[model samples]
Structure formats: C-alpha cells, structure tokens
Target: MLNIADTLYRWCREARPFALATVIEVSGSAPLPPGTALAVDTDGNAVGSISGGCVEGAVYELCEQVLESDETPVRASFGYSDDDAFAVGLTCGGELTVLVQRIDPTDQPHLANTLEQASDGVPLSVAQVVDGPPRLVGRTLSVLGGGSAYDGTLGSRRTDHTVADRVRALLRAGRTARVEVGGDADTCPEKLTLLVHTQAPQPRMLIFGAVDFAAALSQAGHFLGYRVTVCDARPVFATAERFPHADEVVADWPHRYLESAEVDARTVICVLTHDAKFDIPLLRSALGLPVGYVGAMGSRRTHEHRLERLREAGVPAEHLARLRSPIGLDLGAHTAEETAISITAEIIAHTNRGTGLPLSRVPGPIHGRVPADEAPAPSELLAV
Candidate 1:
C-alpha cells in the first residue's frame, strides 16, 4: 500500500514477505475512504490502517491470517453490528470490503518499484486485480504519468491495454477508485475488478503576498497538506524568517513568478497584495488557469476597482466571474490570523460545494461521499 510504502518497501527489501489489506469498497459513513491499507510483516509487526482506529485490530489479524494462508488473496467484510459490542465492526454504521493478499517483492518486483517511485514522489498509479479471474488475482498494472510506458501486466496485452487506459484517466484526476473492466476471453475473466491507487505530488498553494495574512494562511495551507509558496517583490519582507511555514518564499514580481511556476488543476492561488500595480497583472494570469481556487483579499470598494482594472487588461467576463474578490465567506474576521481561517474555510467550502451556512440549516446526511473530483485526499497522505 502506498500509505505505508516506505515501511513496506523496507520490509520487502529485507526479504520479509507481508500481507497487504486494502479497503476496496465502502457503504454508509466511513472515516477513511477506500484504498486505505494496512500491512503486516511476518514478525507480528503492522503498519498503516484500514480504518482510523475502529477496525485496525481486526484488520491487523486479517493480515496475519493472509500471511499464514496459501498465499491466496481473500476478501474480508466488516460492517456495523448493533447486536454485539465485541464484534469486529465499524462504529460509524459503515461497511467496508477489504482485500487481503501476500506479496514476495523479490518475485514480484513491480510492487517494489511502485513503492520506490511513491517514496521518491513520482506521479503514478498502481492498479491491482482483486476480483474476476482467479488466476489473475493479485496481478498488477502500474503506469507512470507524462506519457510514459507502463510496467507489469494483467496476464495479457489486451487486459493490460484496457486497464492502463482507464488508469490514465484516474491518474490524471489523481483519484483512488474501484472499477470493473469487461471480459477478455484469453488471459482474462468475465469482469476483472481492481483498486487503482494514484500517487502524485502535493497540491500547490500559491500565496501572493508576504504580509501577516499570507504567513498565517501559509500555516493553514501547510496543515491542510498543500505545498505553500509565498511570493512578493520586497525581498526584505519575503524572507524565510517572515514566512517560516511557507515551503518557499520568492522575491519576484508576482505575475512574473506565477508564469514560471508549475501548476495544475489542483493548485490554489491566493492574492493578498491589495495593491493594483501587483494585483492587476497577477490576477490576469491566475484567473485564466484551470486551478482549483482563485481568491483575492480586498474590501468591497477595492474589489470593484480591481474588476475595472482586470477588464481594462482584456480579461474575459467569464474569467472575471471566477475570481472570489473580497475573498472568504463573511466570518466577521478582523485580525490577519482570523482572516486566514476565513479564507481557508472559503477554499474548502468552494471545493466541497458548501453554501457557507450552518450544517444544521442544511439538509442531508452529515457525512456524505463526494466524487473524486470534488474531494481528493492527498495521494501521499500517511494513514498511520
């Protein structure tokens, strides 16, 4: 499992065979999502988690059984049981289907290589066949991003091609998914099911300004698992001492640095430089990107002026609408630290499509499943 890739990889290299248990499906409320894995080495040692803590002991024992078995993958289902408190079950009234399999990394070097890549922070996806053809169970297919070739196979070239194509789609979206591929008469089953786990670098949080708000927001962004960067033209204020939480601080023109920075659909750009000289050009570039969120800090009057300037710079009306000027939900924030909380709350609310109203005012379950695009956990998030 990528969650314990570093530990598992070390175990494999040490010639210790281990059992890997991964949650393949979930029904009802689950604290941890599918692809959450728990692995146990030969010596009763365990790493990672299938549940936060509710079912770790049960899953750990499952891993032990898997290791003692005939090296065949099996499915273990856990569900909430109102009848017995001692039963192995989830307390959140959810059901999970975990697939357990044993691996000898020396024989199956594909897993070793995948874990190595994950430890090194490479963008890739590893899909393991958990169902369908009995013989093909545990077969793996891994594909690296950036139009590179895939390694390993699902028994035949056809199956490999079919799974690899779909894996690319999930890899591009950086999602963990359970998918069933259609039958292949040769070297395949009627339906081959897999758990595809994607691993990518941390999403970027570009905070444009070196003020107190940017510094406080950098801590919030970092706590949320984003790679935060603070940029400003003033080198004196942009020093690492000023923005210690930011992963990097750049003393460059905001627009010039953003043009050169590597960003993707998961990036979030925050403009805290209220000055028109910097805000105008920087926003012109950020709003055009397909990043996750774009917000600027300013008053209502300043927001109106910013819109006028962006319009003069020839930004389209549609792109202009994408900006969340006077950024953040109305949280009655006064201090910079409080404003950082308000702004980060807006970023999350936008990503989750929340209405910024009290949960009691909203209707529906408190815990709901969001699509991968709407809520993607960091690929590198540690489950331990």
Candidate 2:
C-alpha cells in the first residue's frame, strides 16, 4: 500500500518472511479500493489495512496460514452474499477480492528494490498472477517507468513479456487494473488473471505564499499525503521554521520558482499572494499548465479585480474558468486553521469530482470510482 511502502521496504530488506494480502478488486460500498495492502510477519505483527476494520481478523488469519502452510497464493472473496461460505463478511454490503501470498526475500529479491523505489517516489507497477495454476498464482513481474526491462517473471518467458508490455502501457497512463492474458494461439490456452498495481509518485501541492494560512494549509496537505512546497519572495516568511510541515521552503518569486518546478496533471497550485504583482504573473503561468486545481485567495471585490487584470494580461476565458479566486469552500471560516481545513476539503472534492456537498445530500457510494484512463488522483488514495 502507498502508506506502508517504507515499512514494507524495511521488512523486505531485513529478509523477514511475511505474508502480504492485497485488495485486488472491490465493489459496492467497500471501505478500501484495489491496490491497498496488508502485511503480516512470522511474529503475527501486521501493517496497513484493506477493510477499515471489518474482516481484518479473518484476513490476518489467512495471512498466518500463508506464512505457516505451503499453500500458493490464495484468492479469498468476502461479501454479504458469501456469508455462508466465509464466516467473515463485510458489514457494509460490499464485496472484496483479496490475494494472499507468502513473500520470501530470497525468492523475490527484486521486491525489496521495488518497495525501495516506490518509497523514494519513483513511479512503477507490479503485476502479480492471482488466478490460474497454483504454480503461477504467486508469480510477480515489475516494470519501472516506461522501460522495457522488467524484473521478476510470471512463470514462462512469453507470459513475462506479455505482462510486461501491458504493465508498461498502464504505467504510462498511470492506472491500475486486473487484466487477463495468455488465452491466444501464441500463448497458453488457459487464461490467467493478473492484478496490476501502479504506484505513482505522490501528488504535489504548491502553496505560493508563506502566510499563516499557507503554513496551516501546508500541514493539511502533508496530512493528505501531498508533497507540499511553500514558496515566497520574502525570505523571512518562507523560512523552513515557519512552514515546518512543507517538504521544501524556497525564497523566490512565485512565477520564477514555478518556471522550473516539476508539475503534472495531479499537481495543485494555491496562490495565496493577494498582491497583483505576484498573483498575476504566477497565475498566468499556472492557469496555462495542465494542473488539477488552481486557487487564489481574495475577497469578492478582489476576485473581480483579479479577473479584470488576468483578462487584460491576455489570459484566455477558459483559463480564467480554471481559477478559483475566492479560494476555499463556503465554510464561513475566519481563523487560518479553519480556512486551511476548508481549502483542503475543496481540494479533496475537486480531485474526486465531488460537488462539495454534504454526505447526507449525496446518493450512492461516498467514494467515487476514478476513471481508468486518468492517473490515480490524491483523493482516490486518501484513507478518508
């Protein structure tokens, strides 16, 4: 899982034999989604979670069985309908398909390196055969970036090449899915199900003001698992002491710093510098980029003036539509901490395509299903 990458790396490096249970598929009102993992060691210790709390005891027992027995990877299904078959059932009426496998460091040495790369914010994907022959069930193959070279194998060389190509395509698109392979004439007639888990670097949140609200928002971003950066032209305010939660504090003009910053479609830019000199140039650049959210802090009157200035600066109408000048949601927040919460909530809502509406008013599952074509947005991975 994303939250336990570092811990998993440590366990792998220590050569500790552990059993890993990963949620490969979920439907209905499942608490967790695919790619979430739980690990159990020989000592009965565990890290991470698949279900919020329900079915954990049963999953832990299954992990223990994998570690103690000679069973191949086990595909366990739990749901309300399976109550008769499985004593452990989800109370939320959701169905979950999990793959439990014993991981030996000696057998899968590349697993440690994979975990280490993921922990260090390198994008990669791991494809594990979960269904088919018992000998192929636990086999894993990993592809880093868009490179053709892959580590490990899924039984035969032909199967490994096929899985690696699919994984590379998924990595390029930044998606995770369960794909079936090896049913064609060139390959084995028996199809095997492979659960591909794509691990992308954490999304970044760039706050271009070092005010008190910016400090609070930086901390909130950190809590939401964002690699936050606080930047400002004023050295005194942009010091790391002021924004200890930020991953980096830089004293530079917002536009100039962003000029060389690494950004992607999942990046969020918060322009808290209310001044025209700093806001206009920085926002002009931010609005043109393909970032997820761009918000600027200001009042209604200030928002209008900013719009006029942006229009005069030749920013397109569509680009202006991307900016949230009033910044946070309508929380009636006055304190910096409260404003931070409001802003963070808005960011989460935007990432999930939510209307910022109350859960009581919204229908269907509270968690939205992200489109497979899009990158794994921050809200999708957030353990809310």
| Model 1 weakest lDDT span, ten residues long | 375-384
Off by over 4 Å in 2: 1-196, 368-384
Assess candidate 2 and give its lDDT: 0.83
Q: After superposition, how far is residue 286 of candidate 2 from its true place, in Å?
A: 0.3
C-alpha lDDT score of every prediction, in listed order: 0.82, 0.83
lDDT of 1: 0.82
Tens digits of per-residue lDDT for model 2, 111-201: 8888898898787888878788787787778887433358997666666766776676566446778888777645545578888888766
What residue runs in model 1 are displaced by over 4 Å at the alpha carbon? Answer: 145-147, 184-190, 201-255, 263-384
- TM per candidate comes to 0.56, 0.53
Candidate 1 clashes between residue pairs 3 or more apart in a chain or in different chains: none
**Maximum-lDDT candidate:** 2
Give lDDT: candidate 1, residue 202. 70
